[model samples]
Target: MIELQFSPEVANARATGSPLVALESTIITHGMPYPQNVETARAVEAEIRAAGAVPATIAVIDGQILVGLTEDQLEALGQTTDVAKLSRADLAVCVASGGTGATTVAATMIVAHLAGIRVFATGGIGGVHRGWETSLDISADLLELAQTPVTVVAAGAKAILDIPATLEVLETNGVPVIAVGQDDMPAFWSRSSGLRAPLRLDTGAEIARAADTRLALGLPGGQLVANPIPEDAEIPRDVIEPVIAEALSLAQTQGVSGKDVTPFLLDRVFHATEGASLAANIALVLNNARLGAAIAIATTT
Candidate 1:
């Protein structure tokens, strides 16, 4: 049996039956640059704690699956070069090879479930990528959500993806896509995708109860809570859509594909928006962290 390495704070939380929220580590290792990456990670954790839950930032280091990260570990991870970007496919391989890896949404959900964590917070999820009809490139995150029992709070699938198709896939998989306080599905970095949500819930308690009902019914998976970015922080759909189109055009011209697609497109979007996208990303992540904590607390009580 594989043993999970829990940080002191997370260990204490688990021991005391306190609420815990799982955080993915790719935001630190791959989502942003070093100092900012570490800083944002700390800020997100702070948000979770302030909202009344302990944050467990999941990663794999030297063959151990760390359910939570210590401060030193978080800093080191942010600065580490050549860290493998792990997902469901590569996670076990990374651990078996004694390699360090940063967990993506799918890997984080898997780890969170293993750690008995019921909720995870992330900036956004991977979904059906554009040109998927040709490339057939879909994220393992969708499948993870269909099988793992940990509820995930994300702004939505990244706006760069085929949002409608992503929603369709989730529906086909029987995963609940719950929009928080809105009828419109949120796009990452933007408050509205313009697509109506399949399910809508107004509060953390509502979302938690839905998740519990699914488990009670022996449903295979968890719910996707599509929380919108704070209004002040959102880029506005009209503003971001054109920027995303230009970025997608550039990606096509450059032949970026597979696992490299998202980071490449995000980099282009970041530059095109003059770093506004990153700022919005940070905002949304913090927002999601707060909601995740709320859901965690709700699940326990």
Candidate 2:
């Protein structure tokens, strides 16, 4: 049997049958710099707690899959260099080989299910990358959502992806994309994507009800709750579109492709926007955390 470990807080939460939300660790190790990453991780966890749920930040450390992390562990993971960027393909390998790694969305969902936690919150989901026709590079997050039973709350697919194609793939996979409080799907940094969402939910209770209904009807997969960024915090689509185009152009000129494309474009956009994009990212993540916690509470009760 695979030995899984939980931090003291998470263990207690699980024992008492309290609501819990799983968080991915890639934002701490791979998405940002040391102190800010650590700070953001703590803030997101606190958001969940304040909303009446426990936070379980998933990671693989020294062959153990951690369902939650202490402050020191969080700090150590943020400061450590060259930690593996783990997804569905390598999660088991990291555990078996005693490797240290941060869980991406796909890996996080798997771990969350194993821990019996049914909800997760993140800044955004990975999706069909631009130029996927030739490169055929798609994120495992899409497929994971189609199979994993956990409910994921996010702003939406990362703004850097081809949103329409991502929606098409989700539809093809029979995954439901439900926008919260809006008719249009959300872009990561923006409140609306201009494309109609497959469904719209007005409240966390409604989202929780949908999840329960899916299980009652024997649905095969989980749902994607596309929570929009807070209106005051958004960068607005009109302002961000040209910026994204410019960033993508620069990334191609720099010969950045495959996994490197996302980080490269994000960095360029961060610089171009004078750090507004990062601020927007942080806001959306916290917003999702609050909503995720509410859904977890409702689902468990």
Could you estimate the TM-score for every candidate?
A: 0.99, 0.98
Query: 1-301, model 2: which lDDT tens digit per residue?
Result: 7877999999999899999999999999988898999999999999999999999999999999999999999999999999998999999998999999999999999999888888999999999988889888799999999998889999999998999999999999888999998899999999999888999998888889898888888987788999999999999999998999999888778888876888888888999999999999999999999999999998943
Per-residue lDDT tens digits for candidate 1, residues 216-276, read 9999988999999999999999998999899999889998889999999999999999999
Model 1 spans > 4 angstroms off = none
RMSD, one per candidate, in order: 0.8, 1.0
Clashing pairs in 1: none
Candidate 2 collision pairs = none
lDDT over C-alpha atoms for residue 93 of model 2: 91
Number of clashes in model 2? 0
The weakest ten consecutive residues by lDDT in model 1 span 292-301
Tell me how far the alpha carbon of residue 150 in candidate 1 is from the true structure, in angstroms, after superposition: 0.9
lDDT of 1 at 17: 96
